[model samples]
Structures are given as structure tokens and as C-alpha cells.
Target: MANAQLFKSMQQSQPLPAALARNAEGTPAYALTPRHQLAQYAATGCLNATFYASAEAQLATVLELCKAVEPSFIAQTAVYCRERGYMKDMPALLVAVLAGQGAAEFAPAFQRVINNGKMLRNFVQIMRSGAVGRKSLGSRPKKLVQAWLNSASEQALLAAAVGNSPSLADVVKMVHPKPKDAWRAAFFAWLIGREYIAADLPPVLAAFETYKLDPAQTIPDVPFQMLTALPLGAQDWAQIARQGGWQMVRMNLNTFARHGVYAIEGMPELIAARLRDPASIAQARVFPYQLMSAYMAAGENVPTVIRDALEQALETSLLNVPRIAGKVVVCPDVSGSMSSPVSGFRGSATSNVRCIDVAALVAAAMLRKNPDAMVLPFEHSVVTCRLDAHDSVMENAARLAAIGGGGTSCSAPLLRMNSKQELADLVIYVSDNESWIDAKRSGATATLGQWNVFKQRNPQARLVCIDISPHATTQAMEREDILNIGGFSDDVFKIIAAFAAGQLDPEHWVGEIAAIDIAAGC
Candidate 1:
């Protein structure tokens, strides 16, 4: 048959059809291996595209575009682009095609490769929830529709986001900007107010009166007001600062105790032993940590051994406020003890700095009920970026990867934004208890934007402090003013519940574990 001969002839010209081929399954003669082929195709574009020229290709492979060409191609393409910031239409069009965005208007060079390049799917993933600047990247037509609609899962949203369809209205509603129900009501209320204004002017806008307006504020910023309620605690993390040629370390054992491990117990000893002398453990060279963290929320029934073992986990586990809204507002202690090796990726001389991941969870908890709620991060000045889950397939991925450690100067940025009154409903600041006042030079860093104006009324702006410094104890926490969130999810949620209920006070938070069964994922 002609088909059989074509398949045979294709193999003769191409190599033995390695697993890394872009259209392996479409080739019909050999099996397709995803990982191996992705790694290979990434290095060279020689993988033929003829086999995947149309939906007919999936008839043979059947794998969704997400599973097949999503990361495998995105990684290579992004890496390539990073190497060259911007190029001719070819590179950008290549990414547009592989990302699942439309590519019809692209140059012939890109069209030539669209068959197997697999860029369409990747582009779709990045711009699922109405990304800020997706329209400029060529024609992002929604090519696939009916195959996956009802299931507005992360992957589903990404696919639907870039595709073109009248059915997309429902899909867009499913992936709108409201952060939670509270946020929707808040936004809806604003819509009604707008409607009232319009009805007073235009005749066509009269029908808008029927829609009920809900008034509520959805997004909350840094929990600045909650800082007073932070549980009074012993210090946990240590800080190191370099002046000229000397490095000094500041350690807090009380915070470690608050973390639940007494200094005399084997836990503290174990941690001390590891840090003081690492050659011993490295000599064994195990695959993973030999011990499960005792820092788990074991409550009163928790075994003494585990309670003892938990002492060492306190360094990173203390003051951990698990689960926030969409994103937790984090300001790294990029000063004395928190400096990174200045020469590596992003800004690093080394990668030994500590990152505060709990703030995002607290922000997420705040925004969990809103579709548009988000947290803003800042240093000397506040960074204006807000994170949203609908913006990506798994909002959690972005949450987990929000790692930044640098010297922090709070005044410059906070003052800048305060002048503009762009502050959110709530604001929370996480730090190691070291203090800085008005450290801004000429450049503005963090802008509070009206926080000072609203401070009298919303003093407890959901602010929580993670006292990583033992010496920082008396400084940052001024009574039960800031909600104290230790670096433990089990207790962190408890503290949040208490704060929400107006009960996260120093008198009630005894550092005791909860008796109820803890969730599996937590």
C-alpha cells in the first residue's frame, strides 16, 4: 500500500526514530517516549513536523497537547529566548505556536515548523486567565474547544484561555478575576454603583438597574494590623552579617524552644551537630533525610521522642504561617544575615539565604474566598506584582516558587506607595526581627500607598510577624499586636482561625498542639 511505503521511506531517511522525536507516534513505525524525546528535540529542531501537521496526528498519539509538547518544548524555547531577549519574528512566533496561541499571521519560517514545534500548548498555559500582555504575541486563536470544556481544571483553563470560541464566555466566567465569593460580592457591589451612575445618564443603561449590587472588599494586603497578635515566642533562626571582612552570627535558642525542642534534648543537639560538623553526615550520604520532622502537629498525644526530634526542625519550621490567600506578602531579610552569593542566577553570590514561604499561604488564606484577592511584596519599596491562581494551570506552582532573599529597607517603598494610597484592604510583613528605619537612599523601594492614612482605623491590617531572631524578640512584636504565625502549618491555621474569630491573643495561644486530626496534605 502507498501508506505502508511512505512509512517505510520516512524511516530510511530519518534515524532509527529515537524516542526524542517531536512526532514519534505520528511516525507510525515506532513507540513514542515523552521525556527522552523532549530532552532530545529540545537540543535540535531536526525532528520532522510533517507527522503532526493536524489533529490527525493526535488520532495516532492521542496524548493531549499539554502532556505531549507542553514543558518539553516550553523549557527549550524559553531557555533559547532567555539567551536572546528578542529576535526576528521567527523566535517569538515559534514560542507562540508551541504555546498553543494562534500563529497564522506569523512568518513562513514559523509556519514551516508549527506542525511539530508544539509551542501552542505552552503559550496557552502561561496566558490562561487573561494575562496582561498576551495579545501582542501574534494571533492567539483558540483552536480546540469541545474536547475539554466542562472540566475547568488548571490544564483545561489554559487550553480554553488561548483558544477562540463563542462557548468561551462560560469558560471565562469560570476563570474570572474575582478571588473568592467575598471578592465577587465586593466587585458586584462596585458594578452596581457604576450602573447607578450610568442609568442617571444614558437610556440604554436603564436595564442595568435590575441587577443587585453587592458591596464588599475582596483583596487584602500585608497583615500589618495583625502583627500585634503574633504569639509571644522564643526565637528560632540565626542571622549572619558581614561588615568589612568579618561575618558575625546571631542565634536565638528561645525561639527554638518555642518551636518545641528544648536545647538539652537530642533534637537541638542533632541540629547543632550537623551544622557544627557536616562531614560526618555527608560521609554517610543518604538519599533523603533519615528522620520525619517532629515539628508535625502531633498535639498533646504526640510522643516524647517526636517532640524531642522536632527541636531541630525549628530553624525553618518556626513562625511558619501555612495557607494564605492567593499569594503571601513576603519581604526577605536581605540584610546582614540573609544575603545571597551576589554572582549566581537572578542575584546570588551563593544560595544559602532563608526565604519566607508562609506569608503567601496566609495571603492565600485571606484570598482563598476571593477570585481577585492577592498580596504585594516589597523591600525598600513595594513591588506592584499580584499573584493569581487562574493565571496559571496550578496557582500553587507559582506560590511554591516565590523565593526571594535580599537586604530589606522598608521605609522608601512604603512611603512612596502610601503617598499614592494604593494600599490593599490588608497587609502583612514577615521579617527576622531586625529593625530598619527610613533606610531609603535616592531610589524608592516599597510604597505603602495610604497604609499610614488608614492605619488608625485598620491598625491590625492582618499583620503577622515571624520572629526568626532570638535577639529580635523584644523589638518586632509589641505585645499581642501582630498575629504570631510560627513556621508550622498545623498551628498556623489555628492561629489564623483565632485571628479571624478575634481570639488570636497572647493569653489564648499557649503553643499547644491541636487535638483534632490534622489534614493529610498539611
Candidate 2:
């Protein structure tokens, strides 16, 4: 009776039962939801003392706190923070988390430090890895050195240079006392032991001109050592398209779109050709849905021609798709809170894209993968869709988005499924997983309760939760039959395939996905 009432109270968003209320730290026990705790970390530069059961347990909690955001969001926020100059520590924290998790790559952290002047210590530590900082030095090894001289006062530059690589004394001897000559002298000093000579000075000088206009906004694609510099006009973009192909275009699509240069005439055909090309097609086959999701989320007003070409490319690719012998139910949460912008994209302008938009797209993609699957969107209520295999992902997304937003009730789908006697073999919910059920009201079973009720009828049913935001811990994931995965990448579905096959469990699920890039030579 006590347990029943505790579950009932959860429906109204009241506190959990005292026994389950607090974690070892005496903090509210919500899975992964650290909104308030994160704020405390930001202010104190340390996690609260009560987050862990004991001093021994505090270490793991600190690591968990570091990895509070999805991986893709970590990359996005790193770029976003540098561009807009917001939460600089977010990048550092992400790097620290990934490092703690045994990830060796720190290229993103290195670039974040060099370009934005944040996370310098982290960058320095990561640079000790041979592969970390080399890519961001920007063709000319002297670009950062020049920027430092131009942007910093003489004393500031000298102070920064005091920690000797070859030694600050050598750099000071090579540099001029005047700030005007400081950049040229610093550039000369950087080149002293390096390849090339004074003959290469012209291109470096030209690159430095653009660098001075905006030291922080340098494009990663352009090399500092190139003999001539060209504005990122149609000609340069065309050359890039010809040489690097669709993959390159995919990487730079957001950047070009932000710069208003993605829609250059004749470019769509080039992109289409690249998508259709056999080599490019093979690469797509390796990561079909992932490539598609990245391309789709790249910009607004994506040309239909490109979308159609991608559809063809996806159909032709031999990407992994595990066939299940049972019916599948995809539940996408379209609750009111899901309408909020994900990551740092908060404000009215970027509000057009929301967590629900991502969830709906993922559901649509899953529907495409499973021809016999059905989608039932749940908010305060459940709505069924009469979807056809012919509908494009965006069309399905539009239909789901049109369902609009209301209060959250994650259990509604399970309850409705029970009522309809149409339990599924597999049920996947793409949601924020913040369910509020009121036991005081009629028809109120918490999600777990509904799942248990549904299982009595369909013992084989399994639950896979795709968390759009990793801000909170999930209740569904506590069970062996339930799997929780996060991130916006379509490659996550491949992980789902592995999980469904019984080849992976929650413990090794993430480890497997993280190994794919290096494993596949991607």
C-alpha cells in the first residue's frame, strides 16, 4: 500500500518516496537530470558534497557530472560557445569527461583552446597527444603566434611566451619591442626551425591580413600555407566540391549556410553527383542514416533535389539493418516541454527546431527501416498515424510536429496499447523521458507501471528509449528489457540493432558505439 501511494504521488510531480528520494549524496535522485546540480557546479567550480554516498563514491559522480550532455552536443556547444562567446567551460568540461571515459582524441578541445583562448590547460595536456593540435595550427605554423602578437600587448605576449618551448628568451630576441613589428618578428621566429623560407612570406602575409579582420573565425578547411587566398566564393566552393565531394560538403554545409553561400547556382548538381558517385556511395553505405541525419540537420530550406538524391543514396547503400520477426511500435513524445530548443539554441529564432523535431525524425527513419512498424505519438494523449512507406522522413516529421504539444504522459502509449490489445514486440520511445503522472486523477499508471501491465499480455515486448537530451537519468532504463540510448546521430540505430540481437547490454552498449569510428576507419 505504501509503494502504491508513492507511485501515485509521482504522477503529480511530487517528491519520490523518502527511501528512493535521495541518492548516496542526499541529493534528489533523478536519473541524469542535473539542471540544478549543474548550476551549483558552475558557481562553485565543484560538485556538491552530498552527491555521492561516501568520499569513495564521489569520484565516479564527478565523472558522471562531467558527461551531462550528449556527445554531438558537446561538439556543437564547443563551436557555438566559441562563435558566440558563451559558456566557455562547457567545452573544457566535455573534454574532461570524454578523457575520463578513455577517449583519446582531443582535436576539438585543441581547436577550442587555440581559436577561442579557453581551456588552455586542457589543450596543453591534450597536445601532449601527437594527433591533437597539429590539424588546427592552420597551414602556417605561425598563425596563432601572429594572432597572439597582434591581439596582445607587448608585455602580455612576452608573459605568455615566458614558458619556453625553445625558450621565451629566443622568441624575445627574434621579436621586436614595438607591437607593429611584433607579429612579423613572431612569425619569423615560428618559421626559424620549420620548413620553407622568406619566399613563402607573401601568402603568410595575405593570410595574416584576413586573420587580423577576425582572428577567431578562421575556417578549418583553408590552410595557412596556401600560396594564394580566395574569398569563399562560388569558385572556391566548386573546387572544394570537386575535390572533397559530398562528405566535405556535409561537414561545411552548416558553415556555408550560416555564411549564406550554400545555395550557389550549379552546386546542387555537384552535390547530387557526389551523392551518386560509387566511392561516395560506398562511404554512405558505411554510415547511411548518420550521413543523412547530418545532411538533413545541416540547414533550413534544403532543396528537394538534394533530399530526393539522398533518399536514393540511402536506398542504394548497404548499411546495416537488422530484421526483426515481430511487430514494432515507435512512440515519439511530443510533450510541451519537448518544444524547447535543444543544447544552447534557446531563443525564438532557432525555436523552429526542437527536441520533438529530432525525435519525430528519428521515429520516421525507424519506420522507414521497419516496413511493418507503426508510430503512435503521445503527449497528454495518443494519436495514431496512417503512415505509408512512400512518405518521406520530412513528411512524417511534419505530420508528427503538426500533432503539436501538450503536457507529458509517457505511459499513455503503453496504456493505449493495452486497451487496443496491440502490444508490440519492440517499443521505441524517442523522448526527453520526463513523465509526470497524477495518481489522484483517473487513468494514471506511471510509465513503469503501464509497462508492467502491458508485459502481462505481451511477455516478449522490449523497450528502447532514445533520449534526445541526456539531462536526466531514465526510469525505463533500469530494467534489463529496457535500453536507453542518446544522441542525434542515425548511427544510434545500428547500436539498437546490436542491442536487439542480444549482442550488447546497457553496460557495453555505449562502449561499442564509441569504438565504431576508429573500428570502421571512419
Candidate 3:
């Protein structure tokens, strides 16, 4: 096909932009349905918020999606507001909550929350909730409290908060200052508020107590306890692991890994136990990669025992993959361009995982679960994947990553199939969608032309293009049989199964939530 003819065919395909496409009613149509909004957020697999094109546009889409599940969304409102910098546009009560969560750099935004008279009652309400605070303020919790304490309205807010919930005494105690160069009042106040085991108090606290007892007291030299009390040591971590449930244990372990402290005693056994637990296995499936990635980022020696457990757990978890019975050819594009990081938000050490890795993971899952499937690692041409049922997801991912990273040719699979006179029930291409095919590369047949020829050769074959990145358009998406999907989720298999069964529409899955009302709040 000529470039002109290829362009014409793409126009007929009605290619939908992955994230911001709208419906006939002019409401936001998310590629995944509104119900999967949180999953979409989690699917980013990292916390860095710069993954999307613009924060404003992303938040707008999120807010619109929240309308589908308003109450649950309301509960997480504070988190999104702080995490995404949506503070300025939030309702006054939410803004006030953010003020308490505090980062000193957002002092200007805090001032706006403080000055809103109508929000005072809501502010007081949040203070009285006694909820464990979020990291909205970054490293400025003390500064936040001080700013509030300096206000003329401080007494009223504090009184109201303490009156409603006495638990805030600890925060208030920490926030207030005593006489110049003295912290006696604050120290005792904090001490009285909580019960502490004798060994748990760090060496610095004993020296502080001695100093208080006598002005002549020789204070022993000790490392100062920074920000959040003493740093969590091996003993503290063991106690934390013993105290919390599986989820809590996993979170604590991950936090430790993030801080470059991974030698905690009993962590390996604890992690293994969680992986094997029936209750923990479901959440384990999605999070083990993230946790392992964290450990890898820390440059810690990841024990083979831990790695094997995660792989086993993922296999156990994916056994629930809605079985799609068919001869399917899974092609993951391993072009060098696919090595680009999926998100702009990732910084340094932890961000090296690329789009090709994501595609390979997906393809591996499909190949491992479905016995009738074949995987091909493709660049400018197609080559067979040496994937066996025994190959782990990471192992297959490594195989794909090792393939030649040259130019992209989305039509490679189709060309291979047509030449070999092969047939499949379905053909899935996992790619970044920068095909940019010319006659020199594709040899007279562009991606669409190759697909058309493949269709004639195997009329029963279905074409599925799973765009792992958010590309604006993809070749062959305009056709009725060609189903285009976007985003990163294992749940995508369920969508594929449903589409194969003719029980769901791919365009509908890729488009906005049809059931959502654009004007319900209006």
C-alpha cells in the first residue's frame, strides 16, 4: 500500500486516542471503564505522578470517572488532592485537611485554605478525626503545625480539635514550642500521651531526661532521632512484622526496601509465608514485581528464595486468567524505541524498566497460561520465542529483552503468517505503535494492507492490537475485526476473552464508559 492509501485506511479505522477520547454526549470516555479507574492508577506500578501528559487533564479525567463511584472516590479525595496537587480546586474542607497534612513549600496553598471562612467547620472536623496523617506536606509536618499555631485562630481550632478528639494531643504537643531553648513541656506531653516499652526509646531520649534532671548533668553523646522518631532498626522491623497482618507486613517490608534497609531479620520467611497464604496470594500477584523492583533499586542482594516465591505466586495468581481457548499468536515488539521508560515521573535507579519489559510480561503471561499459543519477539522482522510452559514470566521477559532491538514493523507478524501459510484463531501485537511503515520497509504492503491479506488468508483469524503505551492512533484499528486496547493490566486478558466470546465490544472497552452520565452533578 502507498503512504496515501495507508493514511486513508487509518482514517476509516476511526482511531481513538487512548486517554482523552470523548463520547457523543461530550462526556469523558476512558479507555477502560470508570469502575477500573483506581486499577488504572495502580497499573502505573509506581507513585511518580508525571506519567500522564498534564496533571490538570489527568485530574479532570479522574474527577469525571469518580462520578461513577462517588462515595468511594470521596474517601480517597484527600489522597489524590495531595498526591496530584489538586488542592487549589478541591472543596474547602478537603483543602483544610491538606493544610494539616502539610509540606512547607505549599504554604501559599495552605494560606488559601486557612483564609476561607466557610471552611472552618470542615477544618475542625478533619482535625477531630484523629486519622493517621498523609504525606501531603512532604517533610514539613512541624512547619505546618507551627504555621497553624501562629495564627490568631489557632486557639479555637486546637480547642475544637482537642475537645472532639483527645488523640490529637500528641500532634499538638509536637507542634507547640516551650520557653526559649527548652522542650520540657513538649517532651513530657508526648511521653505521657503514649505507652512505650523501655527498650524501644532510643539512647537520645535517656540523655534528654538526664539533662532535664540537672543543669550540671553530663549529657551522653548519641545520634539525634530525626523526623519520625528513631530510624527503624532490625528489632523494630521484627516487632512490626510480628504485629501486622500480611498486607501491613508487605507494606512495612517495601518501605524498608525503599530506604535501603533490607537486612531485617525474618523478612525472607515472612515474605515467603505471605506469598503462600491463600488470603495474601490475590494482592501478592500484582505487588511482588513492585516489591522486588524496589529491592533491585536498592542494589540489595535479592535472595533467589525471594525471587522464586514471587514467580511462583504470580503463576498461582494467573491461574485465574479467564481461559481463552484458541490457537493464538502473541507478538511483542522489542524494538530499541520500546526501551524508553513508560513514565516521565520515574527518577534515577528505579526507572530503568521499559515498555518492552511490560509487553514481554503480558505476552509471557498469555503464552504460559494458554497451551495453544505461540509468542514471537518482533522488531523489523518476526522470530519465534522459545517460550515453554515451564518458563517463568520473568524468564520469558528476559528472552524478549534479549532479542534484536532494531526498527519497528507492526506488519511483521502478518507478513510471516501469510508467507508461511499459517493460521491462528487470534493475533495479538503488543507494541508502542510507532510503526511508521513505508514501502521500502513493509515491501508494498503496509500494516493495514498486510492485515487485509492475512485476513483473506485466514478469514477466521482475529486481530488484537494491545497498545502498551498511550499512542494517539494505531494502524489497523479502524477495521471492525481489529480490536485496539490500551493501558497496563493483567485484567486485559479478561477483556480479550470477553471480546473473543462476542460478549463485549473492543471499541466499547477502549472508549468511554457508556453508562456514565455527564451531567448528573450539574
**Model 1, stretches more than 4 Å misplaced?**
1-353, 356-371, 391-406, 411-417, 422-425, 437-453, 457-460, 468-471, 474-476, 506-522
Screening candidate 3 with a backbone cut-off below 3 angstroms (N, C-alpha, C), the clashing residue pairs are 1-444, 13-478, 29-512, 102-137, 103-137
- Model 2: lDDT equals 0.52
lDDT of 1 by residue, 147-214 (tens): 12222233233222332332233333333333233323332333334222342322212222231131
What alpha-carbon RMSD in Å does predicted model 2 have with respect to the real structure? 12.0
The TM-score between candidate 2 and the true structure equals 0.58
| Candidate 2 local lDDT, residue 449 | 62
TM per candidate: 0.29, 0.58, 0.57
lDDT on C-alpha atoms for all candidate structures: 0.31, 0.52, 0.52
For residues 1-522, what per-residue lDDT tens digits would candidate 2 score against the true structure? 369767654653543222133222222323533432332222212111221122223334434554664544334333433332233344454444444343434344334434422234333333333322232323222333344445644333323433333343343333332335545444444434433234434343445445556644443333222312535655554554555535556555555455444467877776766676667766433344344455557566556666676666655542444455588888999877777554324233332456677677777777777878888898877976667757876667768866767776777888898889886788889876666642222222366667777776777777887765533345453456777665554445766777676667555334443232321211
Model 2: lowest-lDDT 10 consecutive positions: 43-52
Output the lDDT of residue 272, model 3.
67
Query: For model 1, what is the alpha-carbon lDDT of residue 429?
Result: 52
Q: Rank the candidates by TM-score, best first.
A: 2, 3, 1
Pick the winner on lDDT between candidates 1 and 3. Answer: 3
lDDT of 2 at 494: 64
